[model samples]
Target: MTRILFLFIDGVGLGPDSPENPLSTLDLPSFRALAGRQPWTSRSETIDRPDHVFRPIDATLGLEGLPQSGTGQATLLTGENAARIHGRHFGPYPPTTVRPTVQDKSVFAQLAPLIGTDRLAFANAYPERFFQHVEARGRWTVTTLAARSAGVRLRREADVRDGIAIPADLTGRTWQRLFDADAEPISEAEAARRLVALLDDHTFVLHEYYLTDKAGHSQDPARAASVLESLDRLFAGVLEAAGPDDVLLITSDHGNIEDLGTKSHTRHPVPLVAWGAGADAFSSCRSLLDVTPTIVELLTR
Candidate 1:
């Protein structure tokens, strides 16, 4: 069977929120539907389903202070404790010291050979401007670095222009303005439909969602709520359009939006929800480092 889709949401966590906490204002129906009814004692949970197992994972790499995106994401995609190696948590970019590890050890790099060319793909399409920025700085985010190193083709403007990839605003909202005019909001449902269309074309498709982290940094309840709602709508659409062979895995690195008490990351654990084949294997994952290995195992099996 095809490995299906993998989604990464940045800087999300699990924690308590008071009235003053902006996170309490957001309506996360899909998240709440999965997590609210259950009691989360640790950073992870395994909800048993007939055909699949749903698991929530911890994103923090067992460190003190808030987990930063740089280290957290590196660990999530590479299965290495980037924060511990750097001596402390880092920022939005992977430290130069970890470049070799990220280049050689990430999921994309390790899994590409097994999946074959065009089978493993990164679905996020970058505009010409973003490519120019990366070219000038010679810098890459953990996701971009991992995918590029693994030999996965980075989605480009041509992909968007030719209807090969979908933008983050698969629902056709405000975010679409960032892209060129040829882009259209296909609605969340249609976006999922298109994603399923690509599943047959590729074995492993990875997508990144950073809006939750952005909403948290802004510390606006209205915006955060809207983000959650849009995400929930997206999830709902994906679920509806998902095929029997399609597996959906959602995870994050560190905590930020789950508790809005501060503008920094939280000590709380991030959630890892899975559906489809091999979900049971994820129930045993304990930290961010375990993610890449788990995905590799699932795909290879």
Candidate 2:
């Protein structure tokens, strides 16, 4: 079976390769080597390598406003024109009207029957407080809703400690700071190993990292670059650890971190970086809606 490791990075886009863009300022050797290019920017055209591909895909979905996570993520997960269905770009969370589609047709939900729920896994570890918030407010992110809809068990801190899951921050530093727990930070290499290991028991594994978006919102160039640094290492590590049958897909909801010029999400196109087995299947992806379907096809075919 072909194993898929999907990394959903929020608020990243292909901006101008300038001082303000971390992809330009930093040396992402792994990213560069895998994609066969450096400083992926607005000027970057499609790169079709023998083993991988790197390109920008439209995140706007032909909408009229800055792309927002709600509709953007829904569109990515469900492979549907969520923005049009909702009549507008909708947030940090999906609108009530759009939640049903995410729950019923997300990549996880769609793949459940074909791959079996037992073979799908969401690798990001959630803290106890997250569950408390969901219990109190009945709110959930698109990823979480999708996972639950497919009966995929959401990983927890214990899973992180057990070497079976990864933290949203890539490292456990944020978890320690937020929860005041006695935990040591793990290196990006170790996190990569843990994530890759999960494929041993499942056919598909997904992990979400959102701090890049938060850093973009902060408008702090240094902070944005720092997070990107961690991600660069994480991606490199995953590529190194993956087996012959493992395919890796890295993408984002919309553009934010790539350009710190504005605190809001940009109208820029986000990158679609694919590597290893089945990587070529995504070379033709033109928009967020194409992601889930291509991934489903990769594994099913």
Candidate 3:
């Protein structure tokens, strides 16, 4: 059986390859190898090699002012035009109007019945504070809502200590500093290896990283560069660890870190980089709405 590891990076888009973009200024060899280009931007064209596929896909869902995460992530996970359904692109969290769609139509919800909940995993671990937030307010991100609907176990700090989960930052340092997590910090490459190792037990594993978006919003070039560099290392490790039977899918919901000119999301297209088994099937994806359906088809076919 083939396995899929979906890496959902938030708030990244193709921008101009200039000083405003750390992607343009950095030396990320792994990204270059997988994407077949440097500083993937508007000028960058699609690369369809025999072993990999890379291209920019639309994040703006037509009726958009600026694409927001709530609708964008919902669409990415559910294969539905969430913004259109809700009559606008809405935020950092899913709106009440879009919650039902995320709960029912998300890739996890759709796949659980076909592949069994046991075969699906959301690889990001949560802190105790997050669980308390869930209990107190009941607000959830699109990804968590989807996973919850499917009865997927939301990983926790113990999962990280057990080597079964990866932190959102691709290293435990942030968790240690912020939450006083007991897990020792590991290198980004080691984090990638841990994520890839999940394939042994799961048919589909998803890891979400939002610090890119946070850094982008900060308009701090150094912060953006640091996050991108960590991702570069993680990507290299995944490529090294993933076997022929595993497919790696990388994409984002909206654009932010690509251009530091503003503290807002851009209308720029986000990159979709796919490699390993059944990667070609994803070549048809042109927007956030197409991602979940492509994965469903690939996994179910």
Better of 1 and 2 by TM-score: 2
Each prediction's TM-score against the native?
0.90, 0.97, 0.98
Residue lDDT tens for model 3, 32-80: 8877755577777797764578989999999849999999999999999
**Per-prediction tally of clashes:** 1, 1, 0
What's the lDDT for all of these models? 0.73, 0.89, 0.90
| Superposition error at 194 for model 2 (Å) | 0.6
Per-residue lDDT, model 3, residue 148, is: 88
Superior candidate under lDDT, 2 versus 3: 3
lDDT of 1 by residue, 56-153 (tens): 56665666777888888888888888988888888799999887889999988888778776788787777677779997998899888888887788
- Candidate 1 vs candidate 2, lDDT winner: 2
Runs off by more than 4 Å, candidate 3: none
What shift in Å separates residue 200 of candidate 3 from its native position after superposition?
0.8
Residue-by-residue lDDT tens digits, candidate 2, 129-229: 89999979978999999998889999888888788888899899998988874556799999999989999999999999999999999989889878988
Model 2 alpha-carbon miss at residue 227, Å: 0.3
Q: List the residue pairs that clash in candidate 3.
A: none
The predicted structure with the larger TM-score, 2 or 3, is 3
